[model samples]
Target: MTIKIAQISCGTEYSGIQSEIENAAATVGGKMVYPDVSYEEITRAVDDFGFDPVSPQLKLMIARAKALADGHYDADAVFIASCFRCAEGALVRNEVRRYLQEHARLPVVTYSFTERLKAAQLLTRMEALVTIVAKKELLARERQVGLTAGIDSGSSTTKAMILRDNEIIGKSWTPTGEVIGSAQEVLDEALEEAGVKFNDLEGIGVTGYGRFLIGRKLDANLIQEELTTNSKGAVWLADRQRGEATIIDIGGMDNKAITVRDGIPDNFTMGGICAGASGRFLEMVSKRLRVEITELGALADKGDWSKVNMNSYCSVFGIQDLVTSLAAGHTIEDVAAAACHSVAEQVYEQQLQEIDVRRPIIQVGGTSLISGLVTAVGEMVGSEPIVPENSQYIGAAGGALLSSGFLEGQ
Candidate 1:
């Protein structure tokens, strides 16, 4: 039942992303193919997305994704793994993003490099179920539906969830500074809320930037792809009210564009290497403006007509633009809206590049509920993006669902 999966890793020559991916793939007993350079790949991908797929780096990445997809040719199915920069965690990241979006092979493209690293690790550990969370649900009819939990140790947040009967019964989130201690604290809190003992759980799953550190310490299973986790969570929340979703997840250091169809995750995209126009960048700018982190959305709504000149979306250099705009007398609201524009643009482009933007959309993550962002993204995306309740919990919820019997114990 091993499906063929293709992984296209870009800027692999410079960053450790390729090495990490390779190591993960090897561990999972999965095969991979990468182009010597990005150019040979542009021609192979179909022009289906109205994209030329001609950017050398993109072609290189596509070549990798194609390779993974090709591996599935003889298998029952195929999954595509498109990866961006490796974790050199430095300035050269611009080169990677520029190379990726030069001609924009996929209209709405997202690399989510950091998120993918965790995904790669999970793929290596449980490659079979990495992209197949939905697949496992078919087993729900046979296996006993047991209590399962997902301990998510995010860079700035610690979260725990309990999924019983495909319902998220109890969930908790706290800022994370110390990994091991924070994980234990949150887990105990979540279990207490659920009124369940640790022994009641069948398996534990973990994800997020801090996953490797805390996940390894635990003996349970793990799933890769924040994309998968988030998408699944979005579906769960949206389904609670029979609402549809086109999720925009803007975290402290990153951003994502996820399209969910009928309460089921269909496709998604991610931002550049670091968090410019993403969460981290937005937070930094918001802090400099002395604005409360949660109030950014409302501030954007009140922004004046002054268009900002800060074009650099890189979080590192974005400060200069913010300052320059302010020196010119732009109000804080005006400046923040411009930042909102930058991020909203990224999300809009990602979803449109893949599918027609006809479906109802939902925005998740920290920025999902932003006041001004919704209208801005709606106007740009051509449809209002709804922010579902508990949007932040989508990914963890998905992980919890996997442990819940709705999938395997029906």
Candidate 2:
């Protein structure tokens, strides 16, 4: 179904990009719907919708007031058209935005007809806004069918997962950049892969370092702590509803240790002092060694990590140690394994201080994809750690599950 955008303006003059905006919306399978309501009609709508006029001077305010008053708009998004040097727009845009944000909750895009307004730029902006609105509308439809999405907007990567009936049908990850854009990218990719529409999702949950930003931008229904979500996710993925387990989640910027007891997150610790145990450290080492991150784990599995002892506690010093080892005739595999061991060792010495090693240990997060790192952590914790599928997406999956009420009251 095509998304419909409500075009609203403050002044009597047209913005002169009506055709361009309409074409751009059409390009993205959307329609531009202009409500031809007069001032009297809007006043009557305010009376009907029961919203008192905030200011009679602000024409845009009246239009939004009327829309809210009537409680009816055929559009999924709202576009504010204004001309340059319009004092009315400047005076009322903020309050108008607040009203729309509070009441309508629909995506709002503004177009200012400045003297330098290029056609290409206008079209691009229109297309982008239309695309965002389309996704929102599609997700609204998906909500009717028991679907939800979770986004883990981590410092390193943005991950998205689509859940239906408490099961993840689609998941995707991309490097985190321009938070809002990446959030959309990951969601779009995941939804497309699942062959689902945006409206299919009943809700959206966000977690991770960038969770707050993405949550606000996406209007997420659930914004959870990474530690809590990861703990819930690890237990869920491991299928361990009862009993204690220690979870090691090493991400790009930080390494987290979550202790789950009887399916509840009891205690958690995050490492911030050193980067040697984090994914960023591994990425740097991989680049220095000219080794692909994906290939490092397999190679490390075969090498003798004990031979290349990495004693550096900091990431900077760790790199120096690795380079020195290479200069001293150590092989790449040995260095890679040593790097993985260094991360595990840091977790044990720093991040895992309060956690019990006697219980089952679950290694998760993007770093868990490295088998050698998983092996190293298992060895340190004295038990073979369980590495669940889509370990990188565990937080997002947990958020999705929480939104679906699958992890509620647990």
Query: In the order shown, what is each candidate's alpha-carbon RMSD?
Result: 7.4, 16.7
Predicted structure 1: clash tally = 23
lDDT of 2 by residue, 266-354 (tens): 34556554677789988988899998888889888987889997975888899999999999999999999999898888889766753
- Top of the candidates by lDDT: 2
List candidate 1 segments past 4 Å from native: 6-24, 33-130, 133-146, 166-168, 240-245, 260-266, 349-358, 406-410
Highest TM-score model number: 1
Residues 1-410, model 1: lDDT tens digits:
33333444445545456666555555655544333423434465533223334345554444443433344223222233333333332222223233333332321223334433643444522343235433534212212246888776665577788866555667788788798788788788888898898888876777676667766787656544566566666656666324345666777665656554444344454544556656666778778899886898889888842488765456667788888889998999898888778766665554344333436676776567677767677778777776777776665665665545433434
C-alpha lDDT score of every prediction, in listed order: 0.58, 0.71
Per-residue error at 349 for model 1, in Å?
4.1
**Local error of candidate 2 at residue 42 (angstroms):** 71
The segments of candidate 2 whose C-alpha lies over 4 angstroms from its true place after superposition are 1-145, 406-410
